[model samples]
Target: MTISSQSARDLTANITALSDKSVALMHQRSMSDEAVTTFQNILQKVQEIHDPKAALRSLSAEELDVVRQAHSLAESINISVLSDEGAANLLNAPGHTKDLNNDGLTTIGEGNMLTFPPDNAPASFKAAWEEASDGLSTMDIPTHMIFAVGLANIGREPGDLNWVNPYASPDYDYGAAVSEIIESVEYQYNHNMMSFEQYQKNMSFYNTLTEALA
Candidate 1:
């Protein structure tokens, strides 16, 4: 029988956790020879799931049943666990790096997958905005600001700095205003003690609104 997508995903997660633990033990120089051997065995099982062999090895009905049951049990377990170093490592990944450009401008986002302006924009303000707006539609706020703003700023108008200006004219740079909000959101994200996923979700909304209006 084939493994369900959910089952494979669950197993992959457990195996990842196991891999993490094994790596830790290696670093600490604390694993016994037997423990190391057991870890390798588990890794092989994980690889079998990840890289299935083309040849279907024969198994007794009972053996197949046991494998099915194990898969089910793995799925039923809660998987929202964070390892001791999960938070620290997540915040420090290459995606979360905060190095700004020479212009003191840089995009910041969680987990790094998206980059803004998509490496291509027309050489005009309207073309840039249109392209940026299209890209922003697919991006979460954390990613757009963190990955795209530097590119967006290539030759665009400077966003407004005085957000509290009650008399700010209709010509007020709303892009800058949205940027300030994003910056504030980032401030709270890095300073507060909250789940990274939650922070990312909240910032997604904030960014969506900003990008939509921009």
Candidate 2:
């Protein structure tokens, strides 16, 4: 029902450190600006930790079963996947006009529910799954089922459909959240907004400095 705490100290450290950067990103504005490239790096890290088969493997049996159920639900719908070109172009489009800094950060315990187009739901889920697959079949059912779903969703709605660990909640729509991160980074990368030297560096102060903090 919970993420594998194989090394509670390391996992806590990673999550605690990553959480601040995630919050800083939540309020960053100016999708047109070069900071967006940093946003891209952050997004990459999130999917890096959560999507790959290796990341999925880190999940508890119950957590993965929950994700598998979500994967199956997503597959049941006919997803109108965009071609590579279309997806590439769409990912680079402009986003919110105004920047934001609410002067407050949101912990996982708190978030606002977001809405997504029904038409795009399946594709978004598929994209998340694909990013997680890392060339392996994400749909391969494992040998056993210890529990039906994670305890986090024990009393929730029948089909909230957001089943990836930690972020799976009725309050926060992970798919929509990912679209925002993707579009910002894609815009900067596609437009050559950051210099090669700068682009190659991890510019997010929060992430880079966290090790020092810890």
Candidate 3:
């Protein structure tokens, strides 16, 4: 990441804020409280990072995974705004696509960006995508289907088909997949991201008519 002095400080503030917000949301969602508290306590080690710029990549890969896991915990449970912009300025870098998780696919960046699988994508990747995306309109819920496909394997090479299975999945188990669809459909409705008919259609995709109307 090309760093200007101003941008470096901005990124620092963003990461710090994201960390704080992430912790708060974890509590609201009644996540594994003891575990979340312990995990964040470890993040305090970052305070030893004196220089804002130095703090950018100061985290080891494992540590970085911890942070992402924390945020993704909240995200896959429902939806998350934690990745908005942070020490992860990589999303803002001009013309650069990075697989932050080193999952081999770099297209699903912050904000759940997308790029189709290469034709040569492994059989596993194709299969995971196909299963998660089955029977859904590629153009419509391709983005939303991401949750069912497994947020952890967004670009994971040799993708795991069980990415959606709770016991084997990488996402938090506090909610159901259809709950995500329900929440997103309501969010779209409240925010006017879609029309009423479209919102109904989205909800009905996974929920029964009674549930959708409810």
Candidate 4:
């Protein structure tokens, strides 16, 4: 089903207000344990929805809307608060890179690959790329999907490239697909590819939902 533009706008507004309130609470509480636990629970709920690729099929429209808003919020949180060092560590972590080649990279479809920044890349670029890549990997989806979404965030359209999934699939998992899309959004925000207002919108959406859910 398609969401109308007005409905989408209204949903965004509601989610944004919720996020604003949550952030205010966090600021007021200085991220106390209670506040942190609440945030973690909300994130856990989002992760649970995205972890099973098939779970999405059962959701109602309202549930799906919440899922979409939550995904955006999760992306913002991952991009804004997840540190470069944290991201790099996840990429280089033992067992994480087993799928990667000697250079710590893996290919997705559409002639795109996710990799640790080369030594020649600027330090800032390397850090951001690693962070984005790391965040993408944490989604517990196929590596290829993660790569495609990351590329998409950078303005590379997988459909335009006639991208083919390298992994065997009965069907594309919608939950995983959405997870990747959210990761790509995080990548864009982390890299400053999105406008500040856009970034704030995402963060507010995420923070507020997190607060309310907490």
Candidate 5:
């Protein structure tokens, strides 16, 4: 489930936008009915996936076991993207191997400009890009998977694995491990481990996910 450099940047940008929106929503003391409903739905989805206590009990035994394992692995990561203390580490995350413009286009980097062309990205690269984007966009994934994928995107490129983790210089494949956990969540979803209501809750579970991880 490792992500390519381009995918990593794109996912990070998307998550950042979501986080920004969450923050904005939090500042409003009185929100419109629609806004309140949206907020509640998001929060419920997040709780469903990230909260063990609130997990859907409808899943098969095997699915539940796998979900537990993935949840445990997700819980072990200590990096908190929300805290000021942890923010520096996040900001210093390694750059992508390829060039990513603020406008969401991926490219190849040179001295001052980026080169954009179909040939610049091979079929494999394009396929991986599509897969990562599609997987992340799905409502079936948990918040842990989202963070894991983002981390994977940090170093999933062909040669970028060498520079993946700043904290642990070598020997660890955090991205791969996290991606597996994400896949496990998907497996649980496919297996009906949780009800649609519970699966739906994880969409807004970022706050709960952050809190649980904290």
Candidate 6:
């Protein structure tokens, strides 16, 4: 899903307002230190979520789900704390990365199959793969996914010419790729091309991919 610039600004403003209201309520209710800390942490996350310039960081699915639920509970406690629309918008906001719901995996798999077509694969597979890859090309690619694809390329064959290692030590290429990926993700985040949640998801997906591939 895509969020227009204006919509993003509106969402950010709404979240900030809601957080402020929640903070006020916590103070009014004389919440315990632990409870206050929880609210404060949630507020910090919400702020980071709406800030386009924030650094890219991984956010687990559970964390986001919890935040969404907490926002809902806060609204229920004080209707003025958060509007229905604001809560919905925050929950439905587009992710910061392009690897939403395994799209990255699909793209990588399709690309690999197309690049090294299996002898037993049918022609129809190639046609379908091409169609899927073409569609993905039109969307913004997450930096982490790009790095993953590059790593996959390097791992495909010992001496594959497609692998370009810019680092002085070839052994450090993977580390360099990781650094580049982080920088690219941050650039996209700062540019508002992707949401903070999406960025987090991309990082989480990348970590999983790395583990499995390793």
TM of each candidate vs. truth: 0.21, 0.18, 0.28, 0.20, 0.19, 0.22
Q: Predictions ranked by lDDT, top down?
A: 3, 6, 1, 4, 5, 2
Using lDDT as the measure, which candidate wins?
3
Minimum summed lDDT over a 10-residue window in model 5 is located at 85-94
Model 4 over residues 1-214: C-alpha lDDT tens digits? 1223343222222221234444454445445445434443443333333212223334444443333333222221232232222222221211121112112233211122354333233454434434434433353222433354354345434234443333223343433433454576688888989876766555543433233323
TM-score of 6: 0.22
Candidate 1 TM-score to native = 0.21
Per-residue lDDT of model 1, residues 4-99, tens digit only: 444333333334233454445443555445544443444344444432121012333433233223222222211133221221122121222222
Per-model root-mean-square deviation over C-alphas: 18.8, 23.0, 16.3, 19.7, 20.5, 20.7
Model 2 off-target regions past 4 Å? 1-168, 193-214
Runs in model 4 with CA error above 4 Å? 1-43, 46-51, 58-60, 71-125, 128-214
- The lDDT of model 3 is 0.43
The candidate 6 region of ten consecutive residues with least summed lDDT is 101-110
List, residue by residue over 1-214, the lDDT tens digit for candidate 5: 1324444433333221224343343334344445434433433343323222222233444433332232222232222212221211122111222232221122221111212212233444345434434435455544453243235445354234342322222333334543465466557778989676765555334333333333
Output the better candidate (2/3) by TM-score. Answer: 3
The number of clashing residue pairs in each candidate reads: 3, 1, 0, 3, 8, 6
- lDDT of model 4, residue 151: 47
Report the C-alpha displacement of residue 114, candidate 4, in angstroms: 12
Q: Summarize candidate 6's per-residue lDDT along 7-126 as a digit string, tens digits.
A: 544444443333445545545565545655554454446554643322112334444443334333332222233322333233322221112111112111111211112222235433
Model 3 ranges with Cα > 4 A deviation: 1-3, 14-21, 24-31, 47-57, 60-62, 73-214
What lDDT does model 2 reach?
0.30
Model 5 misplacement above 4 A: 1-130, 134-142, 148-171, 186-192, 196-214
Tell me the tens digit of each residue's lDDT in model 3 across 1-214.
1224444344333333234455566555554667465445544555445343244356565545444455443332211323322334331222222333323233322444433332234445445445544677756543453443355454653334423222232333223554766787798799988898888667655454224323
Computed on alpha carbons, the lDDT of every model, listed in order, comes to: 0.36, 0.30, 0.43, 0.35, 0.34, 0.39
